[model samples]
Target: MIVFMGTPEFSVPILKMLIEEKYNVGLVVTQPDRLVGRKKILTPSLVKQVALENNIEVFQPENLRRNYQYIIDLKPSLIITASYGQILPKELLEKIPAVNIHGSLLPKYRGGAPIQYALFNGDDKTGITLMEMVYKMDAGDMIEKSEIEIDSNDDYGSLSEKLSIVGSNLLKKRLPDILSNNYTKTPQNEEEVTFAFTLKYSDEALDFNQTSKWNHQRIKGLSPNIGAHLIIDNVVVKVFKSQLSDIIDIKPHEIKIENKRLFIGCSDKAIEILELQQAGKKRLSTKDYLNGQNLFINGGMTNE
Candidate 1:
């Protein structure tokens, strides 16, 4: 029997493929969902929804290591863990040789938030790795891997979708091979391991003093998640869309409000704020935002 464990929208494809292939899946373990959005309605995880559609037994234990004794009692042959939130222990590894589906190629970005961190730090190429689970986090021996090229501008939200599908396709092809034979495992070099920690709200703060290239990279990297913020009159204004304007020889951090448009100068480039969202307000473009809030233009602020 096989055991598949994961959570989030990223992990849904692998679960679906496993069921489609008629693999003997003993159980599906996923994390509980929390409420999101303006109305604060309860939301179900993608994994849970897919599991229900296929009629698979799902266990949404708050802590699989603490609350779920049934998994141990079931004693499955192997565990295929992809984007499972918590870390699996040595005890769990002993029962079955668990293989992890990591988003980045092993010995590189070996942690959570790999897709986002890859873009933030400027990596042109990123890939997935199937590896043997070990005590340490993502330091396991690799079994299979697939690589992909990243566009000049790619964010977590967009890149995540591509990686999720790539990982699913790899699992669909490689699972049967892994189950049939004992493949050689190569250990990852600890020196090459780069930790891509989860993004914090604090990391989204933007600096207009940075170089044009860096400013552009950061804005594009964080576009759909943890958006860049600028301090306007000591207020943190979230930047939704920006473009590098014509080369301007202006002082750094000098915000220009012209024709109800917000412009900030960098070392070698000018950033035109097309869309912005202020505290206690909805996101809007330069034209729409200025209509309702005339004070912004009067106060030398062109964005909401």
Candidate 2:
């Protein structure tokens, strides 16, 4: 029997795929419901929803280190984890052969936020790695890996969705060999290792002093979720989509409107804002934003 542990939308695809393939999934472990938004409404994780719909036994543990005995009771032949938020204790790792479906190539971006880091660094390619779970974070030996190209237009949201599907398919393809204990294991090289740590709230603030290309990467890397923010007229604006412009004459953080389009000056060039959301307001295009209210072209944006 397989015991699956995962949380978030990224993990849902793998869990669903296993169920569809008629794998013997004994139990699913996911993070507890979260209080979301200003309303404080409780929301179930995607993995939990999928588990309930499929009639699988589900466990939501506040602390996996303390509550893992429940998983042991299930007698899982193999434990599979995909984007599971918490780290399993060393005791649990020693008991069973746990495998993790990670979002990036091993030894690179091996942490909680691989997708965001891959886009932020402007990588040409990133892929999924199936590895044996160790006690120390994602520093596990790779069992199998599948490559996927990171397209020029791919943002965090789109790339994450694509990677999730890739990871699920890779796991499905390698499961039989893994269960039969026939797969080869490769130790990740220590020298090439790079970490993708969790993003802080300050990471959302865009610095126009950087080159336009760098600023543009920051905008799309955190798009539609933790948006890249900038101060315009003392009001914070979250930038969702932007492109580098040829204009470079203006000072950094200078806002200009041309033909009802919004552009902001950076160090090397200007950035044409395609989509943005002002504080407490809905997201709007440059044209729609201009139609509703006037902007101060003379005022420079504050970085802080």
Question: What lDDT tens digits, residue by residue, belong to model 2 across residues 1-304?
Answer: 9999999888989999999999999899999999976478999999999999999989999999998987877778999999889989998888889999999998999889998888888999999999999999899999989999999999988988898999999999999999999989999999999999878878878998988889888987898777899886788888899988989887787887889888888888788999888877778887887777754454556767
lDDT: worst 10-residue window of model 2: 294-303
**Model 1: lDDT of residue 269:** 71
lDDT of 1 at 177: 74
In terms of TM-score, how similar is model 2 to the real structure?
0.94
Query: Tens-digit lDDT track for model 1 on 1-304?
Result: 8878898777987888888889998788888876865567888778888888888888887776677567777888789888888877667777776788899988888777777677767788999998888888888998888999998657666787788889989888788778876577788888888887766776677776676556666666677645777666556677766777885866666667777776777777778877778766777897788778744444432232
> What count of clashes does model 1 give?
0
Worst 10 residues of 1 by lDDT: 295-304
TM-scores of all predicted structures: 0.86, 0.94
| lDDT (CA) per prediction | 0.77, 0.89
- Model 2 regions more than 4 Å off: 294-300
Clash counts for the predictions, in order: 0, 0
Q: How accurate locally is residue 257 in candidate 1, as Cα lDDT from 0 to 100?
A: 70
Q: Specify the highest-lDDT model's number.
A: 2
